[model samples]
Target: MEASPILIAIDFGTAFSSYCISVNSGHDTSKKTERYETETVILFNENQEFEKFGVEALTAYTKMTSSEASRYYFFQNFKMELYNQKITENLMISTMDSKQLPALKVFSESLRYLKDHALKALSETVAESLVLPQDVTWVLTVPAIWDNAAKDFMRQAAQKAGLIQDILSENLILALEPEAASVWCKQLPTSGFIEEQAGILDKSTVQQQAGVQYVVVDCGGGTVDITVHEVLDDGSLKELQKASGGGWGGFSVDSKFTAFLRQIFGPVLWEIYKNEHPAELQKMMHTFSIQKCTEKEDIYIECPHNLAKLAAKNKDISSYFSQLEGACWTDGNIKISYEKLASFFTESIKNILEKIKEILDTPEISIDFILLVGGYASSSLLREAVKREFGSRYKILCPYESQLAVAKGAVIFGTDSKIIHSRVSALTYGINMSRKYDPLLHDPKKRRVNKAGDYTYCTGLFLNLVSKGQSVEHDEDAQYTFFPVDDDQTEAGFRFFSTEKLNAIYIDEPGLKEIGSFVLPMPDIRLGTNREIHLKIKFGLTEIKANAIDTSSGEVQKIKLKFMSE
Candidate 1:
């Protein structure tokens, strides 16, 4: 209890959440809420009230109409919303900010509380302890499907919390979620588990638990992320592709379940459900109502068969639960059976597994086992559905703290990268576009450039040499040399290329696919208009710097691509 720890793995998940400290325990013992942890988020409010978190937060917000509890419950895998501008709000709007707090802020506040709790726990345990760990590093897990902006937002929230709370001496950062699952699962297998197929843990254990070549349909609170990984040549593991990111997650699933309940029971005894949960009825309609994608399934509030039956003018909501199990699932009102839930999941698993099959068409990219990690991976419905789609040819792996696996694995990665710079690598090239000059501008020369003249045709990636899943990274400068394609036009009038739609080429059957691609700057060029173009790429932490020069003429210019900094 004397030495304080420097790093902690934080799995801030969708449904349930947990964290693991670097310190390991021996034999059969308690991991106490202190050493290793999970929490039902009953947050302490400014007024010293123990507010809701976890499943409690869920039920509370579901019945709420006020924005406070409703807004705090952004269950969209809040971590992933950081990068994108457009978002769908199925949940009611509420937040500390009267104007509406961004999802990330609410998420941060939750973590801030967790940090405070951790600090208090540490202090309490060590009555008069000396020699505590000097550094404090956070290894935070996020959904693998999250984009840069989502990740950026998480980093920002972490920084704000770290600064505002003054809770740590230093903060080293490591981020990854599903990838961490692969690593931790490989490490925490049972003794009898086979090693040859271990992702990071044991091969046999995976087979006993998950299934082979199986796709892990991790339906969590915010988003469902599917990862397909292959066993490496040395029997290690390598991620092949991110199969899917969906709106279908635990909260969504529960919401659907809730609606289905009311549909069947709305005419029966609603008192039981209401008594068990006083605000249950309101919770369903206002905050966390059951939602459906089916065109046929129209959900109506639970009401007694007659207003006078309950000796009241309004419907007796208590009658709802009596018929909760009577839902007509074919109409999508509720999940009628385990089979039905499994089938619902089966379709989604098939959709993503089909994509994985396409990507791994090459035997070189084949995966042997599917790894399952996340709160909802514990679902009996999802587990069997995954087994059905991707059967026994490959094994499936699941970890104890399945939801927290990513964060823990992130910590392990952080440990490695903290010692070696090359250990932590990323793909970086400014997102750019192609432009057209006065002349020699092919494609859409006469196309009207908009008022911004910051036309889609004028800005695109400078160099996109790094593709997803590519491991070509170093602390070294991102340098790429591009001689004009034609090389003989007037100072190749350089125009970057960007369009409402990205141009991409295909790669099936010896053809090209235009998944997405943009033109680099439209270079205004002539035989000797410019001898050479010198480009320097600089990225320090969260900043990007690009310096371009006409070496022949000694003209230098720097491009600030960022319209507004994060």
Candidate 2:
């Protein structure tokens, strides 16, 4: 007898993936509440597909095997794919199928790999109990930036990955990775608020400073994500505004860094980056990975002797790439300095700071604290950039376990039943004004020359409460008002847009599964449409809200999940 597939929470991130499944006591033995996590990478050989799953695949790749793998390796958190305009048809998972396949298909297979591993973990844990495959439930997390169309693509991928059609309901878990990281950092705090600030509040009986508002400037390998978040009243969160970000991460820096390295160290260096990277060559790789350099700087990185052996069997390259460990390029007996590497990474660090400064200058927004997370967030160059701009406006809090913050926060929130809890504030929503566009005009940028007032077809645009990271108590009323464009039509389309920045879920390093999206209708509304579009966005559980303005119009649009009339 085997235990049923259990309920699990997977924090499938952009750089790394993790699954935290609940483990209870066995049948006939008390159910114990324990949990475990696994890194989300799937490496496999063409013939040894069965041998590849979870951490096992990572180790097996280094071993000698008669069967050729075609070197198929998949890593989730390849979130950088969302913005790349060049990736249209075949993804990195192209070798699997003979023809050019939809990127979505390859992405789904990546997710399938992770889910399959999670199911295996659960199966092994509860082997004594009776379990069924259908018993397992899964919840996945996505970045809070993608729109509905992308998310719709993700839903289809999930279905192909074996989710029953009946259970296939898409819910957007709009977590700002940086904010999520901040929440995780706050939970593991070493020092309280600054001493003088803390004393002033206590001695004067003033309001307690809620906590730190860490601005997470996540400089990832491929993209740079900047997020600002504050702790909520209920030990949760409140995103000050929409997460401001751009395509600036570690990978972006790496490209430029590689170019700079090639300029200085010559082209022979790139051959070492191909195929597998050995321990000794890894030092050189890091040097090449740096973005730029400063005056009077020297590039000397220390590497092991084993790189020569690695280079011999893996990548066929210049003499510098002597196979010492894997496919790593190394000196016969020379040394490399990390000191030079740091100096070379400054250019990338400079760009990241400029982006953050622009975010700070946005209307009605100023980040108080700086949070450092993600792979590149640990870079000393990035930290200095943050320090220069912030200048003690708030202290920078870097968690030792910064990389794992998102996975941990997601898992914690997942296991929390009360976390999804919400309140219903209003019984029904009604537009107070009817077709009133006879209002203010003359912000020429927004309104036409001869219009009653500035009216947008997007009733969804008139949000009254909650921008992004704010955690609300369940059943709270989400209300907003809309002024008609021209008073031309009575009916209005109430489309609901996702409150996220990027709603993409990646499957592996070369493939991306669009499992998350925001559902909104692009309504062709007219002028003078003065009507309050009232709807409710509850605290817990994410859902869709589409609208068809006039049932007679037959025009379907993305609406709030809650009923418009009920």
Local distance difference test, each candidate: 0.45, 0.44
Number of the top lDDT candidate: 1
Q: What digit string (tens of lDDT, one per residue) describes model 2 on residues 32-61?
A: 322444433445444324345445644454
Query: What count of clashes does model 1 give?
Result: 70
Tell me, by TM-score, which candidate is best. Answer: 1
RMSD of 1: 10.3
Candidate 1, poorest ten consecutive residues by summed lDDT = 505-514
Q: What is the lDDT of residue 176 in candidate 1?
A: 53
